[model samples]
Target chain A: MPTDTADPRYDYALRPPRLPQPVDESLASAPIDLDVRLEMYRKLHLLRQWSKRAHDLFLQNLVKGTTHLSLGQEAVAAAFSSAMRPDDYTFATYRGHAHSLSRGMDPGEALAELLGRKNGVLGGKGGSMHLTDVTRGMMGSYAIIGAHLCIANGAAWSAQMRGTGQVAVCFFGDGTTNIGAFHEALNMAKIWNLPVVFVCENNLYMEYTPIDLVTAVPRPAADRAPAYGLEPIVVDGNDPDAVYLVAREAIERARRGEGPSLIEAQTYRHGGHSRADPGKYRPQSEVEAWKARDPIPMYHDRLLKLGTPEATLTGIERQVAEVVDAATEFAKNGPEPGLEDLLVNVWADGGAEWRN
Target chain B: MAELSYREAVAYGIAQEMRRDPRLVMLGEDIAAAGGVFKTTVGLLEEFGPDRVRDTPISEQAIIGAAMGAAMTGIPVIAELMFSDFIAVTWDMIANEIAKTRYMTNGQVTLPLVIRTANGGGVRFGAQHSQSVENWCMMIPGLKVVAPATPTDVVGLMAASVRDPDPVIFFEHKALMATSEEIPDGEIVDTLGTARIRREGTDLTIAALAAMVPRALEAAEMLAADGISAEVIDVRSLVPLDTRTILQSVAKTGRFYTVEENPRVLGWGAELVSIVSHEAFWDLDGPCVRITTPHIPLPAASSLEDLAIPSVQKIYETVKRTIGGAP
Candidate 1:
């Protein structure tokens, strides 16, 4: 809730690198209205709190199984959600709890899913790693690296063929750039001229190893974009305004049937890859550096500077806290699905029986 | 009535459905302009136009994943993997994404798509391109697997697969492509999960699929000359396996034999044998036999390749030896 730039939670001494102008020159100075900015800020906080709570619950053994948290990467999800229309498709990776929330999925249903409760999204069948709700245009959160990029193109192809004008926004990690499907998807998207945006949330690390160590190129996603004939657009992923501007430009371009864009959002994860990984391999100093540039606090400071009322910010924080608390309680009290739930949904007949 | 080659039936079936539904789209390598490597999709590009019929890059992952994504949304797609053996490259998309999405999402999404691939060995395409990988897809939980033997069945089953609500892996046998059969002139649509009794006899039951079905039928004719009556059943769909028809045949004949194109270990026949043994234990007079290709990567040499896959001679000899020795 602190509005002061010198708040102890953030390290003001270590400045984030400035963005090298907007990717689309036409939208270089396009303004983000106060209302949209405030909404993005709200989404950022909601995501931050939801991810933090899920991590906490994991520690307590309430949220079973492993989960990948995007603690420091809320800006990309919030900014993209703000820019995209309600009906625009989103295909993201396992580290997409925040992305699902940003697309307006009820926190309670998502939390229930993570908790393996019966009332959860997908009826608790898809755990944290596979959180999906198609009704909200949150298509799916694929666990395998780089696969969703190709799948996203299929959605884009559908839109193009159907003349829906809907663009598919696929999200993945920097590690995905090394996968073959990533290349295949990009090349095919270009060849077919499909309406899709491939967003790479470059958290600087692929699991335990730093991306730079394994990746041959300096920039994993952006460097490879030119190979697919796409302009390499890299943005400050922690900066809400920078991500918002780039996301809006790329999304609009795809919606207009100009083919896909590869945007590399240089972000970082506050925690390890998953609940099991403590991320001991990463340097303490480097972790602290990325932590200092957390998207939540950075955007909070930006809003305060933009002349947002202090009371309004405090009220939003209060609202987010209550929503997170209610979601926690609902998930805790939710029911466990019965044994019969196992055989259902395997086929169209709603049963797993392969034989008559 | 009209006579169509198995390869021609593939195009006719797909076109039949594409004409019925505007949402159905087809994509594969060499399928559009080149009319497919097996010539199964000839005239489709011209019939449906390039918009519905597309030729993708040599990217199995993209082709299958795009089909899944399109299926998840409103559009239903039919993707071809060129050769069934190439499924190894894009197994994740077909097995993990397309198969599990509907179940994992609790029915929030339905993937209405068919992955048509040329399967089996006989024309010496080698190990990589000749595998009858229906077993690979059969083991997956959320997949519907169908392999048709005759041209008429190909057209009918293709329509059934396309119209089905779930993902179907259609195995078009490479060896059977040149074979032709007569069919009704009007729209021909066959039901999946139904076994066709190719030839009826009482001594034993021969269960087979795809390329193996013709060999089994020929073997039955050879057995009949020796007064050994054998009933050949074409097991069309593997996932919704016609266990009812198979169990009934086993109960009546008291003998069961599976002529499989896949290798000996863990073939689709293995599952059927397990089911028959458990369900019709009293009805079965002896152990079920599986005459299959040896567990080795298929050799490209013509003689060796012909020797490896199940042949009519092999089916006839295996059944005659097993039945003659049985109680």
Candidate 2:
């Protein structure tokens, strides 16, 4: 009620209706099997718990640098990652730990990177914001807003040019949709028929500023998609099954050479934008509401109601704790990079001219 | 050997590289159907078709970023900005994304990417379009800056740049694009960390890059008229600089002077002065002089623009003064 729906500044009129979650269809009728469902649940749970641990480390001053975690938005990462092929490429925003984890990047290496160790990915060259794993198809995580859109387009273009059926998915927040690259990349993708999916994680905030205050349209992905001559989809990002089904459609469409699509995953970040932010700008009642819809417990209760054994659910939780524990211990003991490692990978021919 | 202009040599070099490697592609505004505003990419679209020879929209950041992504994903791309002036829009992608991708990824990516753009300020293209940004790029690490003045060096350096495993910013002088030279038979790819001693002398070592090379050669001719022998060295590649050749020349001459189209303060020539001072300072007979553009933006008017940049006359004066004696 605080925001006026009739305001011309906000594009409430252009947005599509929100997709419902926990549809009438039974769990047996879902696309994924019971085993995959449990795995998705386990990954989402692990992501939530891992984010908590990372926050604790930041607070304890153990972590040297700040990090952006998708604290409340784990299901989107789990669902879309499970939907796509392993060879498919993903370009993520700064809050990409969950997405990287979903793409099978080892937690040990990620933690080591956080610890700035020799055993870390990039050998401590790229800390929290710049984690990359080409082997796992998480090409790179960009910290700049709207910087990765065209990069994703080029990857998808390469796939089409090389006769590879792989897809490229760019994960950004609602704030990034306002930038110029969003329009330019989408127009080019439509013209070239690139196999890319532009997924906007609609967390309703560009840092502390509300999306409505800045964005012309309420649903940027849908409104902007039509401008670029494509139909866009919206899904409940917190619901893994709903998100999974929507992502599957988009991925398969791109794989079939039907060109790119945009999907706005309506989700929320439970924590602040970064470690330094307290998220004081958000209304208190809204935060409590999203917290009640937290994906981990919601999915757990839904699975238990669908005849899943309590022991099976408990065992999944235990496994996740073990993985997080091992990752932390490994990262703590990892070797610090030597001075020589600074010059590595700078050039393929030889070492670069470094300042002494 | 074939006689070719600098523009023709670039197109020919790219075509040859494309023939040798199918992964090589070109992308930039007006490069495909229009053959580039400078006509440097003429006839490429017809030969390679639109896929390999792409004409991008006027999105400098997107085009540069897309090329970096494509290069990282296993294809070699030559992304051209219409002018070096527009490179300000591409600094982030160049300095942060393309240049640092290979190193930041921990050796996971290899970017065989070359960025081509016309530089210098002879034509009256106004302040926005006229700038020699080779110095602007030289400050960044992990990038090879090549300014090819003649037709042959343009082809040779561009060919070498495409074959290089790292990112290279290949600067072609706008005023020298139509200038012709003899390109040798077979492939003429030269080593990057090498300089050409155009005219060797003992009075003063004159180092210059791109358009300045030709001016230095002219200055050498003028200095010869006055009985002053000036060694003219072409500083072809700025990064992975051929400091040894320069040091050896300065050791022999015992005096140094540098000329560039960039502003004098913190110019590319200033870097040469620093290096020569550091390595061969003891051998120097006098202080090194840097003949360059004034500390101001290039003007659009013909007279002002010409007055702003270094000329053969100024080079002559600086060389004589660095020797600190009348010839």
Candidate 3:
């Protein structure tokens, strides 16, 4: 066993040392295409704008219930979604709008859910925290910090047992590292060598407390993975291209049955923890410094430098704007779930007895 | 019919289920290699191999949580929590997740999981290892709680539990694990909610569960010797209790006595008495009688523990008084 002192770079005090630039250099070196980069940039921008709209609606009392906004962590979801196959399973934490959008869930349904409209993904029963679309392989999102880790582990175990090459990804924040469920799920996943990618969107603050104060071992949360016999990778979460390349590699490794990997994406949340927080715990200078590394603008600049026409990007933005607007309108008009719907799924009616 | 011990019946049922369904698996600590702490799962690992009969780490939460996850994804898992007392550590996953998943998910998911754990306090395993929580599980709406007293009942109820679509918590009395009885071959017990009439009489009705069933039967025989005909009724399923059988028996006898190996207050005996009082209040000639372990936790010394639990003499005296035999 290698001791902590053996690797001086594995520091607990300072910020995590960034992985070598372009962790997947071969994939990054592939032929540059203008249209693909423009499309990616537009999708990331749409998520940011849509989150802002939802936040405003929440402030105006148009949306009811709690909503965890992922304003700054858009790139992690966008990159991972871009690398995933349509059939693969994905589970997320309470801040799940980006995950839902990335997995191709209707923006209209997403908006309606955020606005507490009847036509939401869960028929308005599960608000932002509980949005799900099984058809799109979005297994569901949970409010419990690390509870979904077990679910994802179970799903991956199921897929392996059934001989399906499909992989499952569990998305959680740095706060989840402190939970016992997280440790149990990770150990089981490692022992069984299940196909799971644990994506830790380390936004540094667990609600109001900073990660340094909460975690005894102050390091990129991923570095703790080796204790469970897993190789950990730290990536620049602010850069979409970097996140995409690393996520693709991790996904491929899991699909190949190499077991689970921990990818700690060092990112920041631009908004408060939820609709109720003003994010007063964070320093103004730190917020501005992170904003300068905003993934959408960086990817937009890279695409333009690669000869992607501005008109094409503008056209994609217009399409995203229309979809978001329509979803918002649809949610406003969607019917509320009736009281009868509540008791409908309580039991499975078997021929003689209820069976699953 | 063959003579079988209570533990053998449990093992036989599990072995039969493992042979019947390829997906039925058993998991627990030392269950595979050591044949279980009580030897209830003897020779299973050798018969089914490590995959089906798995040995787990000493994590009660993981054992139950993994079984829950497996149950959700098309597997019928029989997870053993070494002692029923340890269930408190994993109650969140067991009660909240496994028990409530079906109701919470609106029936989209069914947890076909059987949590088998040993309960009761006669062996003097002290306070931590010896507590009967069947009453606690009985309060949950979606769960089925069963405590079998005899070998035949153990085999029959276990088979029924494994086949049932919903989650079942099978509580086996550690003390009764050694008792032997005749179990009929190919005898399939139907209607888990129905109570069995272990002894028939006209003077008074004695209702008991698990280890208390034999004690109730012995008390009835003693009563019979004293000219008091006490009918012993084995209340197999606690949650979906056979209230009809109990009420019918009470109606005929005009008196009822409930015995349990649990604490007197808020125990299964209290629940049985409550049911009879509510349904057969007019039929009762005397107040419903209950013989249960004292409210205090089971003591470490065997002598004190014996006094704390209900015995045959206690049941006989309780029954005699219920039938107006003496003060």
TM, every model: 0.95, 0.95, 0.86
lDDT (tens digit, per residue) of candidate 2 on A270-347: 888898888866666677778877888888877887789999999989998999888888888899999788777788
True contacts kept of each: 0.83, 0.51, 0.17
Cα lDDT tens digits for candidate 3, A195-255: 8899999998888767766797765467688888987788888777777778889889989
Interface Cα root-mean-square deviation for all models: 0.6, 2.5, 4.5
For each candidate, report its DockQ versus the true two-chain complex. Answer: 0.80, 0.55, 0.27
- Cα displacement (Å) at residue B183, model 2: 1.3
Which candidate leads in TM-score?
Answer: 1
Q: In model 2 chain B, where is the ten-residue run with the lowest total lDDT?
A: B318-327
Residues A182-263 of candidate 1: C-alpha lDDT, one tens digit per residue: 9999999999999999999998878876677689899999999899999999998888888899999999999888999999
lDDT of 2 at A265: 89
Tell me the docking grade of candidate 3.
acceptable
Better of 1 and 2 by DockQ: 1
Candidate 2 lDDT over residue span B1-327, tens digit each: 889998898898898888889888889999999998998998999999999999888888888878877887888889999999899987777887877777777888788889999898999997888899988888888888898878988878888999998989999889998899787899777778788899989888999899889999998999999999999999898887888888999999998888988877799778889888998999998888878899998899998988899998888887766577533
* Best model per lDDT: 1
- Share of reference contacts kept by candidate 1: 0.83
Candidate 1 lDDT (Cα, 0 to 1) = 0.89
Error of 2 at B169 (Å): 1.0
